[model samples]
Target: MDAATSGTEDKTPHRFHRSLSGLGVIILTLSVLSPGVSIFVSGASILQQAGTGSVIAFLIGAVVCYCQTALIAELGAAYPTAGYDYAAIGHAMGDWAGATTYIATLINMPVFLNLSAIGIAIYLAPFGIPLSATMITFITIATVTALAMLNIRANEMLTGIFMLIEFAALLLVAAIGVWHAQPDAAVCVLNPVHLDNGVWIAASIGIIGIAVNNSSWALAGASQALMFSEDMKRPETIGRIILIAFLLTVFFEIAPVFGTIVGAHDLKAVLANDAPFETFLGQYLPAFLLKLVSLSIAIAIFNACLAGFVGLGRTVFSMGRTELFTAPINHALTRLTRRTDAPWVALLLLGTSTALATYIPLTAKLLLLSGSTTILTIFYVLGVYIGRRSGRTGARYRTPLFPLIPLLGVGIVIGEAVVLWLDAETGRKSLFICAGAYLLAFCYYRFVLMRRPGGWKMRGPDDIDALVARDVVDA
Candidate 1:
C-alpha cells in the first residue's frame, strides 16, 4: 500500500471510533491501576516496614504519580497518540531514546500479562479451582488474544464493566472489614506508640517509592485514551479525563493500604503468605462474601491483562506505522479489512510474545525492568523542559509549577534508581538485562534491520519541520 493510501488518515476503524467519556476514561484508569488484590499482596512486605507510615508512603507516591500525570497530560493535549511513551520520548529525546523506550515497553508488555495470569491463579486457588500454573498462563494468553481481536469499542465497554465490578468488590471488602472488626479496630489507627518515628519515616519513604513505582502498573495505559484524542468529541476534554483517572488511581491505592493496616497486625506475615486480601476476607467476612471478593480479584486481574494487551498492541502498531520496525510489519498494520482498520498483525505479535513468555519464570523480573524503563523514559518529556524554556505558547493543557514538578519527578526516579543500584540483587540484574536488550536492539537497527528493503530512516529536524508545516496546513 502506498503511504497516502495506507489508511493512515482513517486510522480509526469504525468500530474503534466511539467516543470515550470522562467516566469511561476513569474506569479505564481504574482497570489499569486497580489490580487491588495483586498490588496489596505484592506490597505487603514493604508495608510492614512502613508501619503506620504505609499510608503516608502511598500518599507521597500519589503525589509523584500526579506530577508525572501532569507532565504526560500536557503532552497528550498537544500530540495525543497511541504509542505514548514511544512517541513522546522519540519526539523529545531522539531516535535512540525512543527506540529504547519501545523495546522496554515491548518487553514489559508480556510481563504484565504474565503477572495478571499469576494473579488469576492465586485468586482462584481458595475456591478449589486448582488450575495448574501452565493452564493459567495459557488461559491468560488466550483470553487477551481473543479480547484484542474484538472491536476497540467493545473492548472499552468490557473494560468499563469489569472495572466497575472491581471497584464494587473492593468497596465491599473495605465495608466488611469495618463491620467485622473487633473493638480494637481503633488500636490499628490510634496507637501512636506503635509507630516508631525513625523506623516509620524510613519505611514511609521506601514504601512511597515502591508505591510510585507500582503506580506504573496501575496507571499503565491512561495515556491510551489520548491516543484516541482525534476521535474525541472535544480533544481538550482528554485533559479532564486524565486528571480524573489520576485522582481515582490515588484513591484506589490509598484505600486498600489503609484497610489492610487496620485489619492485620502482622502485615509482613500476612503478605509473605500471599493472597493477603483473600485471607483477610476469609478471616472476617462470610464464606460466600469471601468467595465473591476472590472472584472479583480474578476479574480485576483479567481487566488489567486486557488493558495491557490493548496498549501493547497499539504501541507496536504505531511503531510499525512510523517504519521503526520491519516494513512487512508496517505493511500488515497498515492493511485494514473492509470491516475494521485494526492492526491485526500487531495484535497477533503482541499476543504471541505474551504467550511465549508464559513458559518463563522471568515475569516478575521483567516487570521490574519494565517499570524502571518506563520511569527512565519520562525524561523524554523534555517537551516540558523545552516548552518552559522557550516559553512556547499553545492551547494545550499545561502542568502546574512548570518545570518544578517535572524536575521533582526526575529526582524521585533517579533516587529510586539509586536505591535499586544499592540493592544489586534486584536492581543490578534488572539494569543489566535492560542494558543488554537495548544493545541488541541497537545492533539490529544499525547492522541488519536498517539494511532491509523499505526500512525507515530516523526522523531528523527537517522531518519535524515538514510535519509541523503539514499540521499547520491541515489546521
Candidate 2:
C-alpha cells in the first residue's frame, strides 16, 4: 500500500464525485473571485488613490497577477486536489512550509469570510432595510452556509445564477461610465492624475504603486481554481481554467473601474465620497436602477460568501485527510454527507468559526491581516521554483519562461510585503502577526509532527483508474 493511503482502510478513502465540467468549475471559481465585490471595494480604493491613474495601476496589478498565475497554474495542474496551496507547496517545498501556508490560511480565511458577509449589510442599506451590520452578517453567514451545505453541482447552479446577476450589475456600471465619457479621459489613462485636496496633481509613482497593490486584490481569486481541481472532469485542464478565469476577471473588474474613472461627471466629488462607487452610480442612475444595482451588490456579496464557505470547507477537508491531526479529529473532519459527498463536518466547523470571527471587535486588525495575506502567493511561487530546481516537473502544463516568470512573481510579492511592513500603524503589525503564526506552525511541525509514529506523510489525490476500479468492485 502507498504510504499516502496506509492506515485508511477503516477510514475508507473518499473521492469527490468528479461530476463538474470545466465550465462548472470556472463558474464556481469566478463566484469565488466575486468580481462585483472586488470592484466595489478594491477597485474603489485604487480609484481613490490613483484617480485617473488607476488605469495604469490595475494594468500593473494584472501583470503581477499574471506572473503569479503562471506559478499557480503549473503547480495546480501538478497536484490537483482540494488541499490547494497546502498540497502544492508541501509537494514542492516541504511539509514545514506547507504547514506554514495552511496555518496562514487558517488565520486569514475566516476573517475574509466575516468581512464578505458583513459587506452585504452596506449594500442592502440602500434598499431601506433596517438591519445592523452584525445582524446582517449573521443572517448572511447562515444563508450562505446553508447554501454551501448543498451538493457541489447544486451550489454551482445557484452560484451561477447569482453570478449572472452580479455580472449584469458590473456591465451596467461599465455602460454608465463609458456611455458618459468625460473629456480628456483618454489622456488621463496615459498621464494619470489624482485629486489632492482641491487641486488635481500628477499621481506620484509611489502612489500609483500603492494603487497597483490595491488593484491586485481586486484582480485576485482566479487561482481559486485550485480549490476545485479534484471535482473537475479533466484535472489537466485546470491550468487553462485558471488562466481563463484571470483574463475574464481582469476584463470584468477593470472595465467597470476604468469606466467609472473616465465617465465621472464630477471626479472630485466621486472620489471624495466614502462610498465612491455608490456615489458614482447615484449620479448617473435613476433611483430605481440604483436600488437594483444595490440589490445586485448585496447578492454579489452573498454569492462570494457562499463560494468562500464552500472552498474553506474543502480546505479543512483536505487538512483532515493528512496526518497533521489526531485520528479522531481527522475522522470527524473527513466525514461526508454520504448522499452528496459534501464535507458536512468541515462546513459546520467553518460556519461556526466564521460566525465567531464576525464577532471579533478588532475589525481593523482583521482587515490588516486580510491585506497582508497576499504574502502567501510568494510561498506559492517559491514552491514552483523549488520544484523546477529539483526536476519534479511532472505537471503537463508547464509555465512558459521557466524560472524567469516564477522569479519575477517572487520579486513582486516580496516588494508588496516590504511595502506592507513599512506602514507603521497597520501593515507592520500585520506582518509581525503573520510571522508569529508561521513560527508556531513551524514549531508544531518540527517538534510535534516529526516525532509522531509514522512521521508526516503526504497524500495526493486518488488516481482516476484506481477510483474506477474501486467503484466496479463495490458494485
Candidate 3:
C-alpha cells in the first residue's frame, strides 16, 4: 500500500528524495545544456550566417531566455514539483494545455538527445576516425541509457564530473585565446561577417533569423532544474539555480567562441573550421591532448544525453501520476522502484526510443524540427497571467518585472517559432510536425479528459506541493 513505490491504484503520489542540493540541481541542469558542446554545434551556423554578429545573436538569445526563466522561477518556488513547466502551464490553462505540453516533451526531449549524441561523428571525422556516425550514435545511446538507469544521486555525480571536464576545457581555451589575441581582433569581434570587407550587403541581414535560432538553443532547458525540484534538498534555491546556470552557460558558450576567432585573427578560418577546440589545442598544446579534447566533446554530449534521459523519466512519471496520459502508459511510467526510487520504466522508454532513433538517417534539419516542437511548449508562459489572476499567489519567489517578463517571453518565443518556420534550412516542414503534435494532444484531451468531472481545471503549483506533502506523510 506504499503509494510512493508503485503505479497501481495509488491515491498518493510517488515522491522524490529531498537529498539533492542546489549545486546538484545546477550541475544537472547545466549538464543537460552542455554549453561547451552546444556552442560548437550551434556556432557552426553563426559562422555561416552572422559571423561576428554571432556574439550579438548569442546575447540576444540569452536576454529573451532570461525573461522566460524569470516566470519559471516564480512558478517553481510556488510549486517545487518535478512537473515544472508541465505543472505551471497545466494549472493555468487546464488539461488541454498540459496534455499538449507533455506530448511535445515526449517527442522533443529524446529527439534532442538522439541527435546530439549522433552529432559526435562530426568531431570524429576530423580525426580521420573510422567509426561511422551510425555506429557512434548507437554506442553513445547505449552507454548513456545504462548510466541513466542508475540512482539519481549517482547520475548527478556522473554529470558533475563530465560537466567539470567540459567547463575546464572551455576556460582553458578562452584564457589562451584571449592571451594570443590577433591585432585588430578585438575590433573585428564586434563587427559582423558581412562587414569583414568593410562593406555590407543589406540582403545578407535576413540571416539574422538563422543566427537567432543558433543562440536561443544554447540557453534552453529553462524548466529542467525545476523538474528535479522534488528531489532537491533545498527547494527554496531551485528558482535561483536557473539564473545562475544561465550566466555560466553564456560565459562558457559565447566567450570561448569569440575568443577562438579573435585569437587567430582569422574569421574565415574559424568559420570554416569544424573542430575549433581541437585545432586550437593542436597548435598551442600537444597532439595527444588534442585527441583528448576531441574525446571530451563526445563525452560532454553523452553526459548531456544522459541528463535528458533522467529529466524525461521524471517528466513522464509526473504526467502519469496526475493521470494526464492514458492509463496503461501512465501505469508503466509511474512504476517507481526502491532500487533508487527511480522511474525505471519511463527511463527505459526514453532509452529505447533514443537507441532506435540512432539507426535512422536523421538529418540535423530533421532533428532541429523535432526539437523545435518543444518550442511550442514554451507558450505555456502565457498561463502565468491566468494563474496569478486566479489566486495562485504567494510564490516563494516572484519573477521580477512580472507581466512584462512573461508577456515578452511569450512574444519572443512565438517570433522565434515563426522564424524557424520560415527558415529554408529547417523551418516550414518542422512546423507541420509541431502542429501535428499539438493537434493530437488537443484531440485526446477533448475526448478523454473533458467529460470527466473536475477535469476542466488542472492543479496549480500549491495544489501539486500539497500532494507531495501528503505523499511524504503516507510513505
Taking the tens digit of each residue's C-alpha lDDT, what string does model 3 give over 1-475? Answer: 1234433435555666677888888889888878877766666556556766666777787887677767767666656777767675665555577676765556666667787887787667658877877888888777887787778899899999999898887887788778988887756656555434534433245666567666776666656887788778777677778788778787888777777767754445555555545565555777777777776777787778888778777876787777776667766777776677678777788777877766555654374454453464365465667656654533456677777787787777777777766665567666666677677777777877776776644432344567544533443
TM-score of each: 0.81, 0.93, 0.88
Model 2: how far is 155 from its true place, Å?
Answer: 0.7
How do the residues 97-208 of candidate 1 rate in per-residue lDDT, one tens digit apiece? 5566665556666666666666688677778866686788778778777776665666678988888888887676566555555555565445421234333323344454
Best by TM-score: 2
Lowest summed lDDT across 10 adjacent residues in model 3 is found at 1-10
Judged by TM-score relative to the true structure, which candidate is superior, 1 or 3? 3
Candidate 1 colliding pairs? 33-218
Of models 1 and 2, which has the larger TM-score? 2
lDDT of 2 by residue, 88-139 (tens): 7776677777776775557577777888888888888877778788888898
Report the alpha-carbon TM-score of model 1 versus the true structure.
0.81
What C-alpha lDDT does candidate 1 achieve relative to the native structure? 0.59
How much does candidate 3 score in TM-score?
A: 0.88
Which ranges of candidate 2 are over 4 A from the true structure?
A: 1-12, 362-374, 464-475
Candidate with the larger lDDT of 1 and 2: 2
